[model samples]
Target: MKINPKFFIGLGLLLIIGYFLQDLVLSDSQYIIGVKKKRQEKDDSFRRVNGSPLSQAQRDTFKNLPYYAPDRAYRLDAQYQGFTLRDTLRMATTGPQPEAYLRWGQATFILNKQEYKLTLYRRAFGTDTTLFIPFADRTNGLATYGGGRYLDAAVPAPDDTEITLDFNHAYNPYCAYNNSFVCPLPPAENRLNVEIPAGEKAFHE
Candidate 1:
């Protein structure tokens, strides 16, 4: 019996495609697992750890903080625009006094075919190497915290031109769980017109 050459070619192509599809599925599964593990650790801290934002009573009744399902789409690579002259931005908080932060840079990215930008900041008095991003979106006062959510990124080096912004890790401020804590509201420039459905949802809602 003669084996057709085309049959072997088609079989090889199917095997290659199957291998890639399997790899993609594994990658997605790992991402989702990692996100869930981090979320669970946070919940554990809130429930049993000291200095948690949750009150004793709240912690006793706490099950888990709500969050949107993990999605790769919400993670983006943004164009980083660093400032030559950093300016002080006194961000208003829930309390009377405002918190000071240095306007470090800007991150511009496109979502849903539209362009958006967010100003990044650093603590005015700390030696921290993290970039702070407090932002509000259309989800506020509906599915998520009304006061907004916060994201953190590693400070990009001066020559770095791109940074990753993962909305999946966005979290509610401490003030969202406790009224005594004063949390900085998202600056007006960081208020996005779009809805970000990822990250932690409202503690009360």
Candidate 2:
């Protein structure tokens, strides 16, 4: 479901408290390893407001992806279903140094600074944000991910000002990451007008 940024902050503090209270979180070796590695990614995640760990499937997806290149960035343009949109993507300078804007998918974004509806989809458990719908055009499937491009804006930020429409960070959904992942499909509203040339390139596998 769409877990807001507040939930992540509180959970993060608990993880810290739990770290000191090792007796609480040490359920297995894997969990411990996860905590340590995630700690390194805190500054980026916490600052940008995307404070969640990558799902196991997501991590696996990256393993199959090509190595990231810092020199590259994607510029997305949208114009499908009669709406035109564009974004000059910035790298996901957060938790994970993702070639794309990678996270567990829990960030809220305001489309074109719209005040009424914030999210494009409704989340589960009354969260109204867990679902995502992204569309890809001919170039994406052929040149990028065969399934098209993936993008999600579920993240936290110091303030809303830090957030912007960055096409450079657009990415493929987890389903693109891995076949097992059931990613939220982009709805009609989230479609773009032009081509997005940032974030993760087409899948290798």
Candidate 2 lDDT tens digits, 39-126: 3344234233243234544444433343123211222122212112322222321123322211222223333443211122223224
> Model 1, clash count?
0
Show where candidate 2 strays beyond 4 Å: 1-64, 67-119, 126-133, 154-163
Model 2 clash tally? 34
Those runs of model 1 whose alpha carbons end farther than 4 Å from true positions after fitting are 1-4
The model with the greatest lDDT is: 1
| lDDT of candidate 1 over 1-96, digit per residue (tens) | 999999999999999999999999999999999999999999888987687998888987899999999999999999999999999999999999
Candidate 1 matches the true fold with a TM-score of 0.95
lDDT of 1 at 45: 89
